[model samples]
Every structure is written in C-alpha cells, then in structure tokens.
Target chain A: MAMAAFRREGRRLLLSPVSYNSSFAARSAILSYSELGPMGARSISTQAVRNRMKSVKNIQKITKAMKMVAASKLRSVQVRTENSRGFWQPFTALLGDNPSVDVKKNVIVTITSDKGLCGGINSTSVRVSKALYKLTSGPEKETKYVVLGEKGKVQLARDSKNSIEMNITELQKNPLNYTQVSVLADDILKNVEYDALRIIYNKYQSVVSFLPTVSTILSPETVEKESEAGGKLGILDSYEIEGGDTKAEVLQNLAEFQFSCVLFNASLENACSEMGARMSAMDSSSRNAGEMLDRLTLTYNRTRQASITTELIEIISGASALTGFSQSARATDNIQYRRYACMIKLQS
Target chain B: MASTAAAVPFWRAAGMTYISYSNICASLVRGCLKEPHRSEAVAREKVHFTVSKWADGKPEKPSVRSDSPEE
Candidate 1:
C-alpha cells in the first residue's frame, strides 16, 4: 500500500512540474526539418538553444534505441518470410495458369493483422481492397470478402456491400492449418459463384515501408505466359508437378492447394507489417516524451537559480544593517565607561 | 450469403481427410476418374496417413528405415 502511494506521489510530481510549459514550448518552437537541421539560420535564445540541444540529444537516444529493436525484429521476421517464399511460388504460379473452373463462385481472401499502429501498412491494404471491390462491382459478379483481421474487416466493411463471409481474428494464437484453409477453399470453390479470386496484403519491403499488393489468387490462365517466362529464366526444375494424375484433375487439386498456400503467405506478411508499424510508432512517441523532459529540466533550473539570488541579496542587506547597529552601540559603551571612570576619580 | 450444401455429404466433396465423411470418400474416388490431381493428392496423402498408424496402435514415422537391424 505504501509502495503504491509512493508511486502515485512520484507520478503526480512528474505530471505537475513547474516547468512543464517550457517543454511543450520547446517542441512548438521549431517546425520544419530544415530549421532543425544543420542548414537553418535562426539564432535562438541561449536558454531555448540549450533546451533544444538537450531535447535533440534526448530524441537521438530514443530513436537509436527504437531503431535497434526494429532491426532485431526485422531480422527474425525476414527469415520467416524468406523461408515461406519458395513454398508458395509454385502454388501461385500453377494457380496463375490453370483456368479449369468458373470464377463467378470465387472469394477474395484478405489477410491483415488484428492490431494497428504499423505505419500505413493496414491502410494501404485497405485501400487496395476498396479498389478491388470497385472493379468487381457489377450486378451479376458475385464477390464476397473473407477478412483475417478485425481492423481490415472494419475498414473493408465500410465500403463493401457484400456480406463478409468469414472473419478469422485468431491468426496469432492459431497456426493456420491446411484443414482450416481447405474448408474455406472448398466453400469458396463449391458454394459461391465467384469467377476469380484475389487477395490484398502488405508485402513487407523494409522496416519502414510495406507495399500494399493486390495478387490474383485464382484465374490460373493469366499465369501461363508468366510461368513459361519464369521457366525460361533457368529455375524451372522445382515448378514441375510430379504425379501420374490426369492433367485436368491434377490442375483442379493444384488450384486449391495453391490458393491455400497464397492465403497462408499473406497472413505471415501481415504479421510482419503490423509489428514493424508498431515499433516505428512507439519510437517516435518516446522521442517526443524525451524532448519534453529536457525543456522542463531547463526551466526548473532557471527558476531555482532566481530564487537563490533573491535569498542572497536579502541576507547581505541584513548583515550590513546589523554591523552598523552594533558599531554605534560599541562607541556608546566606550564613552560611558570613560565617563564612569572620570566621575569616580573626581569623587575620590 | 453463401449456400450450405447440407444435402451433399462432406466426404463427397473436396475436403481434407480428417473432417471428411465416409460417403464422400467413395464420391472422391469416383470423382478422381475425371479430376486426377484431386485423386492423386488424396491418394498420396492417404498412403502417408495409413503408414503412420502401426499394428500396435502406436504412431510411427512414414519413412521406411532401410538400416534397421531386423532388415
């Protein structure tokens, strides 16, 4: 209980410092990056100058720390993303070429993370989804959305007239299985009258930028030339479908398998993008907080010095007055002692 | 809204083995006559599934151990 009270008091003191305004004033004092950079020609006040230096130093420390953390996370996520890359190339390539079934029964599977604050990763994907929706908005074209994240569901739901067929929010908790994806794939293939399917997701470019990409998940006929072209590029050995099954039946099964593969890949990319966005947002916030602390410390120091100077002046004046009063009393006491000695001599 | 094909049994359609109904397996085999990819992938997967189950009810690796002392 005592510890809690102590923490509360500490928080209050930190919250209501005398120099809080100075910190806010410091940030507002500078507007542009050029003004903040080495090339700007504004001569600042000594106090403001000191505060700015301190604030920038504080900001540098925070951004540096955040950059390190992001770098580490990017390394791990990059590995996972890279490992899953080859797994889907054949699937995606095969699905691109085969045009066996009608696409009117197709569904677009969109993968997005549940959380936000990862830059514009989610927004970019949402925008792409909206674009795709607009393209497929004809009266007879049956298009339904299957969203993986609640954030994407909410965003796409606003613009899309078609009902969301499924929303899978437990992506992080549950490792997506072929069984689950097959159920969705089957429903999409057999139940809906989709002509083709597409997926919109953030393809992680770097720690800072994620490109929102719209990939075709169905209508395999579009991929024939691309696959053939990719085959000519000298890496076609793994692209071979190894089975004795008849071409039509083999292609159909391969289509479902490929769609599931792409769906899983999109989910992973969404996770990486979400984490990266969160890391960057948190970094900027910590930097802003650090700058505030610097300006407040400067103000607190100035106020303390002024109060000390006032006390010093009062002390000096009181000392001088005491000296004058004591000197006069000493002179009077000397005169009285002399007078008393003279009177005693006269009386004797 | 999507259609729920409740009249058609689960195992008859293109579904993973574990969740499929018995009737669907027969349908799948018949369906394989026309759709070879579905048949082949299912056949390959089912072989793996059967081999993983041992005579003593213990689960075993699907790979054949050529270096076993008994062999």
Candidate 2:
C-alpha cells in the first residue's frame, strides 16, 4: 500500500509544478517508515478508500435494475404483436397479386395506439400519413378520411378542416365486426366520387422493426377483373345445380358475395399489420434503453476509480513530509518524473 | 387389304362435339366449388348454373346452344 501511494505521489508532483511541496513530503514519509514513525495515520486513509468503493457498487446496482425492467416490458409487448400474424400472410399475398387497384381520389384509413412510449411507432405513422397527403394533387375535396385510432384521429384532425367519416377509437377494447366494416364499405361504395380506396398502416417486419404500408382497395371494375382472373386460380370449383330456380338465385348471391369477401379480407389483414408494427417498435426501444444503461454504468465506474487514486496520493505525500525523511530530494524528483510519464501514457 | 374402314357415329370418336362440351362442363364445375359446403351441393345436382348474355338494347338470352332436334 505504501509503495502504491509513493508511486502515485511521484506522478502527481511531476505533473503539477505547483504541487512540488506535496511530493517532497511523500518521499520523506517513505524514508521515515523505516524509522517506524506514524503508522497509525496511514490506517485512517485506507478506510476512506473502502467507503468510496462501496458507493460505486451501489450506482452499478441501480443501472442494472433499470436494464431488467426495460427487457421485461419488451417481452409482453412482443407477444401481443406476434400472436396476430396468422391472418396477415395470406392477406398480403392476395393484395400483392391484384395490383390494378386505382387510388386517385381514394380514402385513407389509419390506425395508431392512443398511448405513447412504444417509441416512434405512432409518430412515424403520423409522419407517413402527412407525407402521403402532401403527395396528392388537386383539391382537398377529392380526398376523404377515416381514422381508426385516437392518435390518428387527433393527428389528422389538426390539418383537416372537414370531419372524418369514421373515427373508431373504441375499437381497441371491443372485437371487430363485419357489420361495422361492411357499413363503412357500403358507404364508400355508394359514393362513386373516389376512383379507388386505400388504407395506410404499419406492417410489422420483425420483433424490432415495422414498415409503413399503403394498401389499395381496388375500384369496382378492377375488382371484377381480379375476380375473373382469380377464377383462373380455380378457387370456385364445386357449385352444382339441379337445373332450377334455386341455382339462379345462388349464382346472383355468389356474385355479390365474392365482391364483399375481397373487401372484408383486405380490411382484416390491414388490422393485423397495424398490431404487429406496434409490437416491433416497442421491442426495439426497450433494447436500446438497455444498451444505454450499460454504457452509463461503465463510465460511472471509471470516473470513480480516478477520483479514488487522486485522494490516496494526497494523504500519502502529506504523511511522508511530517516524519524526518532520509531520502534525498533529487532522487525523489527523478522517480516523480518517471511516474508522471507512465500515468500520462495510461490516461491517453 | 384396306377395302373399308368401320364408320363411326357423329357423336363418337369421329367427331369433336362431345369433347368440347365436356370441357365446358369441367370448367363450370371448377368455378363453383370454392365455397365452404357448396361442393357437396354441387355434387348433389340440386343447384343449376347458367351463363346468360345480354346484347345491346336486349333483355337476356341463354349463352349455350343445344343440338337436339326437338328444341
């Protein structure tokens, strides 16, 4: 312990020209140690060093606790998001194959969580919707809006002078309905004002990533073309008729039902995509917070170690000067110079 | 050696009408089977399916033609 203090004092004295007196005193204490003078004073300084170390350990404990909490929340949110994926894959495939859906004067329905802290999940969607709106040419009358979540409604309402056609903030708690979805579809279908319909939402890409997507609900003519083309997929193969009026009625209903099926399928898929996106965004943010906490703990430990070394050198040098030192001042100065060079190299 | 070849009936191997009509029936069968329980009803012959044509300013007419002399 005395040698460690002597080495530390030699560095300090060489580095700071103003602290020469302190270094001279430390050398004197080392020389006096042989004479067995003032050993009791050195014991008090060692106890103070132990106390400093204990405080540093406490800080490390707090940072580790925060990392654990963030990780736990990430897990639950990821499960909620991933469970809804069963319905998304086939839906997206259907959408991709039928690409003729026009969207010149269509309505966009967006969903976002009401609560924040999922980190940028809500804001990124809002920004994407705003950019989509800006990309439109022609008058505002050409565009219609439907907002699915509270956050989306509030965000769109800020820029929109006209009221939204449908705002479904209550949907988070309740189960979705064909009635509500069909009613919305019927209302849009009634008005031939729009060339096509589109929905904007986030598509979950992974546990920690989501991409903004714009899905098209094709126009009536294009839907007919798709159904006709889909007939090539031979999905409609088992209808048998007894050669009567019952067959006629069934065919008429089948034609209408086919169109409605496509609309319902698209909407269901859009909803699943939104939930998945939310899960991924939250998971990534939780991971990032954990990494930040680790770096902070490391920095806190290093700064603490430096402060302890400084204090030890001060006490050792003060004690050495009080005793009658036999070591020459010239020899102490040479040792001090070499020590400062080593410390400077370590710091750099 | 080939004094005469056996004569086949018009609707038999000598003609193509049967094959073409059967292909249309096959297509119709394929088109209606995708619905849930509709496949069983289709197999039972309880439902009749037809395609109709509507010309300009005309009401409707059956798109298929029959070769029966009685019709």
Candidate 3:
C-alpha cells in the first residue's frame, strides 16, 4: 500500500507543472477551433449568398422586362377590340336570340397562349371546358375540340386526346391580326362540321386578373332559322330588298364574317388577358426574389459578425498567453537559484 | 381583286398594325358591310345590301339590262 502511494506521488510530482500548463493550452486550442469553425462557415455562406443574389437579380430583370412588353401589347389589343365592336354588336344581337337545344353535336374552341409562366390562364380554360362538358357532352352527344395554343393542346389532350380536331401553335411568333382569324374561320368551316360552336378564352379583367369566358357563336343551322323569322315580328322585313343576294346567301356571308369577328375579338381579349396575367405573375416573382435577397443578406451579415468577434477574442487571449509564458520562464530561473542556495547550506 | 380593293378602304390597313396586315381585307369587309340601323354606316360598304354603286360613284346594278357599269 505504501509503495502504491509512492508511485502515485511520483507520477503527480512528474506531471504537475505540465498539467497546469496544459489547462491554458486546452483553452487556447478551444478558442482556435471555434475560430476556424465560424471562419470556414462565413466564407462559404458569403460565396453562396453572392451567387444566389446574382441569379435572383437576373430573374427579376427578365420578369420586369416581360411585364413592360405585356403592358404595351395589351394597349394595342384593346384598341383593335374596341374599334371592331361596330361590326360585331348588331350582328350579335340579330343572331344571339337563337333557340337553345339539347345539343347533340357541339364544338369547343379553347384559346390559350403558346408560352407558359403566365399563371393559370390555360388551365382555367380547360377547367371551364370540363364544366361545360356536362351540359353539351354525353353518350348521345359528340364534342369536338379546336385548340389555339400549345399549352391548351397539351392540357386538353391529356383528358380528351381523340376530341382535339385542330391543334394550332407557333402563333405568338407574330402578333394576331384579323386575316389570321378569318383564315382560321375559313379553315374550320371547310374542315369540321358542327351544330353549335363555343369559344372559351381568358377574358381580361385588369392588370391583375383574367377569367375564362364562354361565348356562343352563330352556327349555320341557327343562322338559317333566324333569317327565316327575319328579326322577330319582321323588324328587318321593312328594309327594301334590292340585292340579288338571297336571304340565305346574305346570311352565309354574314355567318362567315360573324365567325371571324368573334374569333378576332376573342383573340384580342385573350391576348390582353395573357399579357395581364403574365405581368402580374412576373410582378409577384420579382417581389419574391427581393424577399429572398433580404433574408440571405441578413444571414450573411450575422455570420460575418460572429466570425469577426471570435477572431478578436482569439487575438487578445493569444497576446496574454505570450506574456504569461515569459513571466513563468523567469520564475523558473529564480526557483533553480533557490535550490542551489539550499545545496550550499546542506554542505555547510 | 383590284376593283374590290378600291371599293374598300384598303388604306385603313397600313397605319395601325402592331401584329400583322394580312387580316386588313377581312377588317375592311367587316367594316363595309351594312349595319341595319345607322345612317353613316349605311353609306359605307354594305355586305348584305344591294350594291348601289362602286366607291368611284359608278353603278354596279345587276339587272337583266344594267349588267355592265357603262349601262
């Protein structure tokens, strides 16, 4: 037991100064380790924040430019739509009063944009079509589709692939005009046959909203019936008939014009709606980017400050340790001189 | 086609195009067509009306004897 006690004392005697010195070294090592941790994190966060900010800024630039372009385009479309009302309004009144039918045969013309990122304009049309499908479609009824843009074509084809009769795309390559509508009308006339025609498009509400609207156009059968009645109670019968154009013939031309007119006006309205939707959508995305930028900047600043504070503490502690080492070395020399004095006394 | 061009206001197609001009003829045809209730619009091209005269103030009556403009 005594020998064991002696070994323990010997070990303590040999390690006492080193153990006392090691406490300071351990404290300095902890400070240095902590300093490196925040130092690395701050650098990585700084670079990441810079890259994220740059990309978001670029996206914001693109969306802002899109908003401006959409605004300008909306103005032009609005003008054309307003000016054409003279031809379309009265013509609509004459034909609008057609008798409703159980509608065994119906054709739906869905209008959307060739591009995306404009919000739910395209899906809204498709969803409206689904609602209308219950009214006009059944085992007894046949419904056909004419799609005006790629987005619509893709979405509708998912549900009604076989019903899509005409899929038109690449229209945004040029601004829409009356001739295209007319030609499009003529094409529908020659290729497809239908009893009733319905056009669904995004109706422009404002710079912030658009709603999908359904408008019914005069079909050949309805026009034939309306002309026979001659403006209900023969209001149009008073006009002196001077033309070689038969009543049916006049209506044939009018029907063609009417189709093109509705298509043209709807195209104008939809184009405006598309721009409005895009503008608003872009506006929000830019705002979101701005918010993200603000958050990242805050995180970056806090991390940098923490790293700086850690470094300052490290520098002060390291300077004090260097001074303590010098003082301790002088004290060790003083102790050794005292030991030598003790030996001289023993010899005496 | 040339005669139809002069009779309709083909010049209306030039100035106001941000998209395309191909549909100008369609617009002219739409414009010239008669509106049943108006006075000035009645003076313009009337698609569903009798051709009273051409834009040149010459006649295009299609009766048995008045087939030609000179008649």
Candidate 4:
C-alpha cells in the first residue's frame, strides 16, 4: 500500500519509489564492494553508482516498451469503438425514458477492468456503486449489482457481497467481441430481475481523462410508464415488432438485445480508457527513469575523479621520501587494479 | 436508426448485410415493434412469462480467462 501510495504521488514527487530503494541498496552494496578500507578501496562509491545507473537504465527500457505497446493498443481500441458506434447507438432506443426508476429495486451493472496499474478507473466505479448502494438500499429498496471485471468485483466484494448478483472476470481478458457479452446478457435476463438496469462504466474523455458514465436499461413496463409520463410522444414506441412470436417473447428478446448492446459499449469504453491510463503512466515512469539515470551517472563521475585526484596527491608527495617509495608504489599499483575493476563493473 | 440492428429473426433485415454484424455487432433492436399498441400488448404479456424464465435457473458465469496480459 505504501508503495502504491508513493507511485500515485510519484508525479509530483517527481521520482520513482525505486529511487529510494535503489539508493539504500547501493549503500549496502558499497560496504560489500569496499573489501579494503576507505584509503585502499578506491572504487566503492563509483561502483555503487554504476550499479544504480544500470538498474535505472533497465527500468527505462521496460517502461519505454510498455508505453509503446499501450500507445498502439489505445489506438486500436479507439478505432474499434468508433467503428462499433453504429451498432451501439441504435440500441439506445431500448433505454427506458421513464424518470420514475425503481431506484429501490435497480440492477446496477458496474464495468471495470480485470487488470490494474491503469489509475483509479476501477476504484472510482466501485466507490460510486458503494455510495449508491448506501444511499438507496433500504426496506423497500435493494440494488443488485452485476459486476464486470475482476478489479471491480474484488473492490465491491470487500464490503457488499450479498448485493453482488454476478461477477465476470474474463470480459476484459482479450479484445472482447459481442458473443462474450451476449451470453452475459442472456444470463442476466435469464436470472436477474429489476425495474431499471443501470450500467456504470468508464468514459474515455481524452488521452489523460476518463470519467465514470452511466447507461440504463428499463423494463418494458417501466418504458411504457415513462412514455406515458412524458406528455410528448415517446421515441421507443416507433420501433414496431412484426414477428409471429408472442408479444412477451419479442419483448424478452428485445431486452436481451438492448442489454447486450449496452454491456458491449461499456466494456469497450472501459478498455479504451484503461489503455490510455497505462500509456500515460508508463510515459511518466520512463521519463522518471531517464532523470534518475542522469543523476546516477553524474554522481559516478564525480566520485571517480575525486578518488583519482586524492591518489595522485598521495603518490606525488611520497616521491619526496623516495627511499621507501617502492613500498608506496605497490599501493599505487592497487589503484590501477581498482580502476580496471571499476571499468569492468561499468561495462556490465 | 442504423442498419446494423436486425429487426427480424435470423437477421433478415433488408439491405443490411451480415458482414456489418460480424465487423462491429452494431445492429440491435431492429426486430422490435414501432407501434405503441404492439409494445403495450407485449408489456402486458412479460409479467406472466417472466416468472417461468426465472424458474429455469440462472445461466452460470463461465470461467473464461483473459489472454496473457502485460505485468
């Protein structure tokens, strides 16, 4: 939790939490790297800095790769959603126009993703569901939830287990198509009952912004009531049914179609938003890794130069006592070995 | 308002092709009645049939896993 908190605050903190852990690890590494005392151990600080730099560079590479993948995915999902707009909009006709929602007996469908690290997209929906439940569920009012995505299910299950009508973990596993959602609609229609079905999902407003949005599917009776409530003619009344099947069967199928369409749109929008969040998060992490690398390289060079200058001063002055200079010369040779070792570490 | 929705059974909506459905799953509610009286009659009918549908038991949630995702 602390690590997550640090990551969330990392943008303004302007550093990854790893920087703290890396520096601490490097301190311990310096103690181990310096087998000789400070005077003989010429590469302690430099070796530690080198290790830090390598890890930072590696992180940057990973974040860069993730950012690229997320960018391409975001683009593809955007196209998919745009292309499917024709399919989703027609079904909006099934939305109940009735203002008198049985908020008491509403079936709320919360759409979240199975994955995490994409920001607060999943948590926001869960929070809203909880708030709505707390506010409305009472003696005459009970709101059942159809939770889509593991993240949202886990979040909601922490508090309101009984309120959850169903949880779907696999909807966001792939680029989900209609068939997967069709079965979910069938399940809900075959099982759950409500006067109003409310679908809650994330809406991708822009590259950096997504908001939780709601769409509702009303019962046919509620639709009729809503239409009657409105003094003007209702739009849904125009969708004429002609099949030889019974009126009840037609309405049931229509409800299934509307339910499927709404579910499909919610999942698509949530996925698109999730991809966007990941892209932005990875882009920032990559940039932070670059900055840490710059700092580590600078620290390594300064320490190396300082160590070299101090050694040269000791060697030059020792020339004054040339009688025993041979013994001191051996000490200088150790500096050469240390430099060679440092170079190898740097290469690694 | 769109051609993606098939208003008839077996998706026999005229002029709209199956290709569109496969491409985007865009068509919906094309089979519903436009006349208020037809829907009114259906609304009257759903109350009686709904109980039987519920008695049939809920379709279980499938254990479908997502494709391997990024860490």
Candidate 5:
C-alpha cells in the first residue's frame, strides 16, 4: 500500500513538471509501456535514454531540413504550375473536355514523382489509374499504360506489367519545361497509338490538398468524327484558317500541340503537388518527432530520478541500521554493568 | 492571337515535324519571358540523359545524349 501510494505521488510530481493535461498521463503510460515491452527485464538506464534522445533529435533535424527544402521548392513549383496553366487551359477550352467520348484504343499516362516521402500522391495516382483502367477496359476497347516517373512505374508494374507500354523516369532530374515535356510527348505519341490519350496526374489544389485528375486528348480523326457526328467540333468550322491548311491538317496540328501543352502543364502541376505533399509530410513527421522527444525526455528523467531515489534510500537505510545496531549494543552493555553492580552490592 | 492569322508557321512551311515545330515555338515562348523566368526556363530545357532502345525483350547499350531546345 505504501509503495503504491509512493508511486502515485511520484507520478503526480512528474506530471506536474510536464504540465500536460490528465489525458497525457494515459498517453505517456501507453507510450512507456510499449517502449519498455521490447527491452524486457532490463532496467531503463540514463545512457540508453540519452542515446535514443540523440537519435530522435537527429531524425527531427533531418525532417526539419526536408520540410524547409520542400517548402522552398513548393514556392517555385507553385509559380510554374500557375504560369503553365495558360499553356494548357486554352487548349482544353478549345478542344473541350470529353471524358465520356468513346474511343477504340486508349493510352493512359500515369504521372507521378520519381522520388517519394511525399504523402500518398503517388499511390493515389496509381489507384486512380487502376480504377480508370477497370472502367475503360472492354472486349473491343484496348487500353495500354504509359507510366511516367519511376515511382508509378514500379507500382503499376506489379499488377499490370504486360499492359505498360512505356515507362519514363528521371524526367524531373531537371526542372520541367515546355521543350522537355514536348519532346517526351512526341516520343510517347510516336510509340503509342491511341484514339484518346488520358493523362492521369495529381492536381495541386493547395499546399495541404491535391486531387487526382485525368485529362483526355482525342486524336484528330476522333475529333473529326465527333465534329461530324456530335457537332462537338462545329465551332471549328467557323474558325478561319490563314495558312491554306485544310481543317484536318489544322486539327492534327492542334491535337499534337494540345497534347504537349497539356502534358507540360500536368507535369508541372504534379511536381507542385509532390513538393506540397512532401512539405506537409515532413512537417507532420517533425511534429511527431517532437512529441516523441518530449515523452522520451519525461521517461528519461523519471528513470534517472527513480535510480537516484533508490540509491539515496539504500544509503539512508544502511546508515540507520548501523546506528540502530550500535544502540542495541550500548543497551546490552548498560544491562551488563547494572547486573555487575547488583552482584557487588549483594556481596558487600 | 495576332500570330494566329500569320502565314503558316515557318516550321510547318519548312517541312518539320510537329515535334520540332512545337519545340521552336516553346523556345520562342521561353525567349519572350521576363528576366528571371526566361533564364530558369532556358536552363530547364537543357536536359541530358541516357536513352536505350529495347529489342527482343533486352535493353540495348545506353548512350549518353543531351537534348537541347534547339534541334
């Protein structure tokens, strides 16, 4: 009972110094239990505590640095993404977004980052791409994947290895530009034959939020068909061509230009989303590390104090026992002297 | 928009593929950007990498190549 009461008092004292709410007591208890479970039977030493603190501190430093780097990169990428919007938005407005347009052959371009440690952006892209594949696959409809970035390639290769038509990596080793992206688009266009090109990428909504978006570009033949059948391209008939180029040739050029423009814009947006996700991810990691460090410091202090208290108690109890033994010895001596005096008195 | 009525773009008249035409257009756009962004955009277009062609389920030897905006 006394030991339990002493333990409660010690906890109260420890909790008071930390100034955490009552809930922290339970949380700390859980944390300490989990931490101690793996090192069963061994007492918590201050040396071990210090080592763990050092490691956590190092990790916290790394996370903080990563967050800062991501933040700076996000600023630049955000600007580029905004600027690149002009490059693609006009094409979308001109061509019109036809998500439901039925096409025979489809090429799905999954855009993701080469590096990870960003949140779930890559996985989200892959998931959306997979969902899109399932939606678009049919008996007559053929679907192929052109995965961009190493991360998406590895993930998509796991399930749809045979379906991957092309995989491009190291595209983001340098900053993205229209020229670079156009070359990539041209390369893809030459390799894959698709009536409709579906580019899947993470669209940056904000620093903390992003949406997986699929933008489609229809081939010139498909556009002509839509124009004739659905009158979707009726607006095209009204436009005057200055170059003596036929409507078909104009549509062809527009389709190719629009493809590259949209690709460049999508890559920029994905890069922005990646940096933003990474920043937030690193920020949360640093915050969690701080909380962990606080808990560890508390446990370290508690362990150190307990060891000190045990040593002090051992010393005090040992000294008191010695003094008590001497007192008993002195009492025995008094009784012996008294007995001796009584005997002498009787003899007299 | 003013250039829309201009005679078919020079690249198109010169019998260039859409790739080279678009690249020239992109460089022209980059060249027209303001100071900081122009340099940044120009720098970004300077890409160097190794490209390998795969044949018979085997990758050919990779070769070092740089892709400049200027063809």
Candidate 6:
C-alpha cells in the first residue's frame, strides 16, 4: 500500500511542467523510484531545482533591464517621429501621390534598424521590399534596392542578393536628423539611376502595433512626363517660376528635397517602431520567466516536503515494527500525517 | 485666393543644389525649435557609417564616413 502511494506521488511529480527542467540524473532517479517504490525515489535532488531557479532569475533580471531601456528610448524616438511628420507632410501634399503610374527603373530604399531583439520590424520591411520587387520587376521593368541598416540587408541578401545596389550600415549609432538624411539622399541620387524612389519602412501606429508602409517619390523627369501625359497640370503649373529658373529646374529641386524629407521621416518612424517592438518583446520575455519561476518554486517546495515525509515515515515504520505496534495503527498514522502535510501545502 | 507672389529663395539665387539648400533650411528650423528639443534634434543629426557598394552578388570594400549638419 505504501509502495502504491509512493508510486502515485512519483507519477504526479514527474507529470508537472517543472519536471522539464529536471536534470537527466534527477529524472532517472525519479523513474527508478516510481518502479522500485519510496526507498529509491527518496533522493529527488532539490539541488538541481535550485540551480535552474537561479539561472531563470538571472535571465529575468536581464530581460527586465532591457525592457526598461527600450521604454525610455521609445519615448524620445516617439517624440522625434511625431515632430518629423510635419517636416515631410507638406512636401507630400504638394508633390502628390501617383501610385498607379508605372516607372521603368526603380530604386527601392529598404529602411530598418541595425540592432535587433526588436520583434518583426526588420522582417516586415524586407518582406514588403521583396513584394515590391516582384510587382516592379519584369523583362522591361528594372528594380534595385538601396538597403539601409544591417538587419534588412542580412535578410534581403539571402534571396534578392542580385537586386541590392547599395548597403548602408551603422546609421542608428546616433540619432537621425534631416541634414544627415539629406546627405545620404544626395549620395543615392548621384549613384543610382532610377525613375522613381520607393521607401519601405515600419510606420509606428501605436505602442504595440506597427504597419509596413511604402511611399513612392517620382523623379523630376518622370513627374514631367506623367504630367504631360495625364494633361492635369493644375497644381504644378500654378506655381510661378522666379529668379529666371525654368519649371524643370524647380521641379528637380522639389523632387530632390522631397526625397530627403520623406527619407528623414521614414527613418525616424522606423526607429520609434523598433524601440516599441523591443520594449514589448522584452516585457513578454520577462513575464514568461516570472511565470516559470513561480511554477519551479512551487515544485521545489513540494519536492522538499515529499522527501521529508518519506524520511519521517521510514522512521515511524521502523519504530512501530520494533516496538510491536499494529500495522493498521501505523498505516492510519501515516494517512493522518499525509493529511496534515497536505493542509500545510494548501496554506502555503 | 490671394495673389501668389513670385520670389526667389536665397539658396536658389546663390546657385546651390537642392541638397545643400535643404540642409541649410533644416538647420534653420532646428535652430528655431525651443530649448532641450533643439539641442536634442541637433545631436541626433550627427551620424557616421560605412557604406559599401555591391556588385555581382558580392559586397566590395567599405569606406567609413561621418556626416554632420554644420558641414
């Protein structure tokens, strides 16, 4: 009967999720104990349990610290992202969006962060860039990528290695600004020959959510051609030229300036999204660690109590056998003791 | 609608390219911002990176470059 009771107890301990962390020796000991009865399983090592708990606690601390850091960074980047919308929105309104117009040569600027542990922000940008490539590329249409930051480059280089024209890294070491972005834009314009520039980035929608967005800016030549072909030049024709500059020159200036503005705003938005994603990812990791710690602690306490009870029973049974006490009385005593232990467990 | 005036921007009259013209405009806007935000924005603009051009599915050597708003 005692052997049956110990076997049942052993089975319950082994079934717990906490047992997954148990070392091979400890698990083998439990298995042998269940088969050989209480005498064998008596030494379920709480030492291994304690070690696992310590490691888990250290991990939780690191994740908690990362969460706090990400939160603080998110605040500053969010402010910059909000303020930068005003810098780019006016230019976007003036130049207008021509989504349906097809351009033969395209430069896709994929924007992402350098460091990771931020969720899917980089992957989303790469995914959207690949989708854009599929939509734009054909025998006649050519699409090239100007990948910014390290994370996107790593992912894009896996499949679309041929399409990548330029790779820029370490852009996130400092905070982003319009002047820096304009220089990058100028370099891109000087290097790549494209009729349209498509920027792919994660747009920060909220603390927990972000959307992959693509904003396209037509080249001045493409704009002029589209306007002439469409024959709806109300907005562009309205602005009068000054300083003896031709309409084409003004359009060229506007296109270049607009690229810098949009690029600046997109980089800021991606930074904000990266921070927010990291904050949430770290938060969930810490929470999961906490939950695991709670379960392991409970199992540890239970194992300690079970081993103590087994020792006590061994002593009592030995004494009763020597002192000529009835087996039935000792069995009853053991049942009562088990009930008391269960009460203590419930209280704890 | 009010009559739109035809006036030349100073940068354009000086024959500056749009990149330099816009950089000056951005710095001016940054200067106009209040207190801590102005300083913060200015600091954020300081960037350094290594750019590498890729050809035939391989990356060439990288060149280190730093860019500041003042330049």
Show model 6 residue runs off by greater than 4 Å: A1-42, A231-234, A327-348, B1-17, B24-45, B67-71
Q: Each prediction's TM-score against the native?
A: 0.52, 0.43, 0.65, 0.65, 0.77, 0.80
lDDT of 1 by residue, A1-348 (tens): 654554454344334434533543354355332256443233222344556667767776766677677667667766777666676787644344332323454466677777665567777777777666656756665667767665776786665634565555544543333333444444345434444667778877776788787666543332333345554322432456554433333344445556656665666676777767767876777777676766665555454333333333343344335444553344345434544554455445
Q: Tell me the lDDT of model 3 at A25.
A: 44
The residue-by-residue lDDT of candidate 3 on A114-193, one tens digit each, is 88988888899888876776678889788778777768777877767767666556554546655555555555655566
lDDT of 6 at A66: 98
Positional deviation of residue A278's Cα in model 5 after best superposition, in angstroms:
0.5
DockQ of 2: 0.01
The residue-level lDDT of candidate 5 at B69 comes to 68
**Candidate 3 backbone collisions, by pair:** A179-B23, B32-B45, B33-B47, B34-B46
* lDDT of residue B66 for candidate 6: 93
Q: What is the alpha-carbon RMSD of candidate 1 to the true structure?
A: 20.7
Pick out the ten consecutive residues of candidate 3 chain A with the lowest summed lDDT: A307-316
Candidate 2: tens digits of C-alpha lDDT, residues A88-195:
345444434333343456566565655444556666666866666666535644656656555666676676636355444443232333333343333334433444
The parts of candidate 4 lying over 4 Å away from their true place are A1-43, A93-100, A231-250, A320-348, B1-71
**Leading candidate by DockQ:** 6
Which one wins on TM-score?
Answer: 6
* Candidate 3: stretches off by over 4 Å: A1-45, A97-101, A225-242, A323-348, B1-71
3 against 5, candidate with superior lDDT = 5
lDDT of 5 at A199: 94
Residues A179-223, candidate 5: write the lDDT tens digits.
778877777777788999999999999999999999999998888
User: Docking quality tier of candidate 3?
Assistant: incorrect
- lDDT values of the candidates? 0.52, 0.45, 0.60, 0.62, 0.76, 0.79
